[model samples]
Target: MTNSKVGHRIEELTTPAFLLDLVKVKSNCQGMLETCKAMGVSLRAQTKTHKTVEGAVLQTGGSRKGIVTSTIDECEFYADHGFDDILYGYPLIAHHMPRISALTRRLEKFHVMVDSKLAVETLIASQPPTGKTWSVFLKVDCGNNRAGVWWEDEESIILAHQLGSYSSLITFRGLYVHCGNSYYAKTDVEVEKVRDENIERLLNFVDRVKERGVTCETIGIGSTPSCKKPSDNMKKLDELHPGNYVFLDVQQSTLGSCIVDEIACRVATRIIGHYPKRNQMLIDCGFTGLTKQGEGMLVTGYGIIRDNPNLKICNMTQEIGYIEPLKGKLDFEKYPVGSLLFIFPWHSCATAAMHSVYYVIEEDKVVAEWKPTRGW
Candidate 1:
């Protein structure tokens, strides 16, 4: 379905279509690349947000390399499309060995992340594809409290030593932390504080490991909020892997990672019905189209209706959204039936994952349609 409607305006597209602003996407990708260069660190762009090959290519700045994927499917999809230096930045389990082993063999620089002794032991027990060693990254929990061994835990140091002990079977890559907690920050100052704190903790852990004589070839941390507003101290790290910056969302904007005008993705819907009696208009988008992720977080409800700040998405069903005004009445005359309305998603990643295809727009016209590779 590539370029399905190459020359049509977005208003002509079917309702509830996912739209990607090509220009904004390019700007976002280039900005991140330039940010990494200025910080003197590499950018291992994550592909979980927009999983299209075109987006990934733009992310890498046409290098076709240095990407960390969240799933084996994304890894294979990139590999199948000639992307190299891929990292399966997820916890390893015995169940994923076969596919991991294959990916390790297939790419020149494929790596996996692990946070447990079992993962290291699993890699030690299984031999890599003949001439390869199991490249592993120690996932460190630096305040995010998600995956990865805790940075302050003595067990974290022991785990690194354990991986070092088996040099023949496994190669300890480095530390990877997801600074997801940065999302909780209420202001830009708090976001930078979280970034600096996480970096300090991670570097301290690296020093402790160095005392034990374990070297971390690559050290990196990532979260859209942190990476987008990078601290000067981020230069100490070796890499930054952030995905959501490709399509800055309302959430990112609120975090000060980007302004609302920079958001590159939107759900294009239309007015399906008008109910002036109840002061509400019905849009052809619901939880399925825009997702219910940012519910109660934004005053506008599930998503921000572009160019219509007064219009609020008050409620939604599976395939319909109820819209009214923030204050008084919703003038149905201004929003006639069949008129198009674009919604900037609250969480671009969650919202993007719901759509099968993305309409690539430039100057209000659809120039291409990108089909993202789906599934875990």
Candidate 2:
């Protein structure tokens, strides 16, 4: 789904459009790839953040060619784009088997994550007529406590053995864990501490499972915060899957994962009204433009003004954003009506999902329009 209107200027485009700086995006992807290479781990670029084929190809860098997707639609989209090795990172549901089965036949390698016995049973029962075995990864909960079985749980060991026993229908891939808690960290020390702790826990669990005669071919560990500011302990992981590094937001900036300048995506909006007496300005962007993801200390509102860092998107209606100074009196004269402003979202992933297309910006001009896959 390519938008043929390429080389349009940012100002010429409609207001409230998502802008992706190709330079920053490529730099982020290259940095992560090099980091994983230096740490001796494979980089399974996560596509859940930037769900576009262009972004995926950039992330893979034509090497390793591994990607992690969060939805079956994403699986189909990437598979159609000739991305053969894909991991559907979410826990498996029984009803998704038909599509998963189809994908397995089409893809060179298609893997799914599972954390329960029912998921395994469902996969075995729905084994496709193609006779291709389903690749499975046991999702281990390494302190995130979001999903997956607890790392030390004895049942996890039992589940691993059970999965390994299904030699005919299933190929046990490895262990996967997301250090989501690292996003809550406020300092670099805390971020590193969480990263190291996750590594140690994942390694310990891998050892425990190995002792039980289960071979984990891969040990996946990562989140944007952990992967960007990884500790020396991360050298032991087999692969890293960090998505948001593609377009860092205020949340990552606050977590010390990246600085504000590293953020690659922003919303370009125009000031529609100005309330000089109240020191507030209304912009043609709001929750519909930038998602309300208040994840970090630096994000006190809907989003941050890129040029005026101190100006906060204090409130938002469906289509209107209110901007006001956070530290000092708002200077309405500095921002007149019809002025263009770029807003860095608090969470890039959520903000990106709101837009169907991304306006690629390079050297102060729109280079291309990237259409991301939509639907669950």
Candidate 3:
């Protein structure tokens, strides 16, 4: 079941190994499940962070049902593996209709999100499998302008009305929002502010849709920062989808989603060389292992070295990372060559994308290996 034989000791494994702490993953997943439960909403956990089947199972608390994906391939991958109620939570394009049709016919509840008029028209023109209809969720902006139609814009209502009009071909499920702006908040209060604001906007938009005579069967919002610390207003929504909480990163910690200890995934690298002359060291990890998404945002550099505040990953090449002391000169003796060091990534989704296989570890022993599905 492993892609390759994993060694007993973590230190024995190859450097730059993607390590997933199974215990923390379970705890994090449980915490999110409890959060959604307390909020009185369904948790349609997103699988874009750790696209492994095992992670999805844990996110769903073994139900293997209620899940959303960032790509169509993930939708198919999950469907092929017996998961249902899958939503291709991306802005739909015409080219992907063939596969979408296949998934719609295969799964009991395969949904798609749309934010544009072209997407609505495309879905209307494309007939679903015999006796089947395309389940659609209108993506609303709700202050996160990344994708979704703007909540204040008239087009948002127009699109929803159009989707609902074609009842024979498209079943307008409801509204969906990303609420990604919560990450921009520096304090927990600020994060809550963003979350509450988005909720207010979303609910208002739902009211407008209802005014247009379109009934929203479900209303959902996602983003680890907001979903982790859900407010009372979230109870009004029907679903919450947060993916990065399963393997929280330093960014999530800063956003008050989880503490640094709750981060379940890390890049296990080793000190390969020490350069006292330049007060720096080199590790066998680079942009290829841990992405540079955290660049300039963290004082600890690309990633936070676990339990080593003095160390900072300053720079990275293709296969090597530059580490330097955060304050004073480097004490090379303390960190000997070949010694193990784990780096908590700033963005787990980006870091996870860099590795094909993740070593699932428990108490420093490799218990399993998780291979994620790749490609857009």
Candidate 4:
């Protein structure tokens, strides 16, 4: 039934094709499932990384099928596809109220994160579907100090109380935090240290809210680097909300979140230009195919040329990759003009965001054509 579709995907495949290994992708999905189930924690895998119904279906294990989305566009895409529980992971922004309100109606259980008084106050002002209860989670900043509120902050505890007061305006589901700082840890021991600090900080807040007689729903934490090592500390929270696990990339692999074998997606490109004199080759894949964003300390190239790890395709313009040799000088003879090459991106999110569609590859052949729901 899908042979022609696969064939079409291969034929129309131009330069910089997104190649997804179905087997690896599914394995990564089930691994996340096992980690969540074993921890006795609710696993709501974030779908923003792979904003497609096909991707969501793979993550639905043991009837717990909820997924997290960073943008309202993803929520809408998945909702129409019949995905019920959608958590917009980002703090609800000011101008996006209309969509949030509309999406709430479409979803069976729609939740958004909030931390600042301004955001909470704005959400209240938006008056999104008063008849329909909109769930909210307080964003806790354990250590990363990004969008979340400090766990012990009096202002945060007070807002939780205020939001809980209005049953009509909002349903205070729980407090959520993302241990984003774990990415900086050089070792598992260091990551575990961050984990303990994060959990302790969040638990302290839970204790404070409970003292105020405020009913707390769930305690949540996310981030691929932190939750990737579930045995270390992810289960400490009631739920884990790691997204990049869907399509593990170079960044996650280096962090030990995933193995090189677990990387589910890659960019397929053809060698076009070879500068034998300068010891540089060029692939049709460029910054558009890869990401401008690189990984930590190591000069994480735009993306990795997986076939040859030693040879880094370091520099990239819009349409070309300045490929260099890992060993000796000129090796244009090794790679023919039409040879297909695979590239592992610096970050999965960046690569996924730019591409319109991804081709599921199996046994070195194209299989399923999955279209990502892009924007916001």
Candidate models: Cα lDDT each: 0.92, 0.87, 0.92, 0.80
Score candidate 1 by lDDT: 0.92
Model 1 residue 254 distance off true place after TM-score fit, in angstroms:
0.4
Candidate 2: TM-score?
0.96
What local lDDT does model 2 show for residue 247? 91
TM-score of each: 0.98, 0.96, 0.98, 0.93
Q: Encode model 4's per-residue lDDT on 1-376: one tens digit a residue.
A: 5434475544357768888889998998898888888899988888888888888888776343578888888888887887787888888778878888888876679988887889888877876674687689888898897888887679888988887888888889998888889888887778777877888898889888888878888898878787777664556578888888889987787777877778998888888988877888888877887767773333536666776866777688888887786666756788888787888887888898878888897776777889999878
Q: Write candidate 1's Cα lDDT for 1-376 as tens digits.
A: 5547879998788879999999999999999999999989999999999999999999999999999999999999999999999999899999999999899898898999999989888998899997889888899999998899999999999999898878888888889989999999999999999998899999999999999999999999999999988777898899999999999999999999999999999999999998889999999999999889988898999889989999889899999999999998877889999999999999999999989989999989998888899877
Clashing pairs in 1: none
Q: State the TM-score for model 3.
A: 0.98
Q: Give each model's clash number.
A: 0, 0, 0, 0
**Model 2 stretches with alpha carbons more than 4 Å out:** 1-5
* Ranked candidates, highest lDDT first: 1, 3, 2, 4
Rank list by TM-score: 1, 3, 2, 4
Residue 153 lDDT, candidate 1, scale 0-100:
93
lDDT of 2 at 370: 92
lDDT (Cα, tens digit) per residue for candidate 2, span 283-319: 9998888876773345447667877868888788889
Residue range 1-376, candidate 3, lDDT tens digits? 6346465779778889999999999999999999888878999999999999999999999999999999998998898788999999999999999999999888999999998999998998898999999999999998876998999999789889998899999999999999899888999999999899999999999999999999999999999999988777899999999899999999998888888999999999989999989999999999999989978998899989998998899999999999998899988899999999999999999999999899999998898889999887
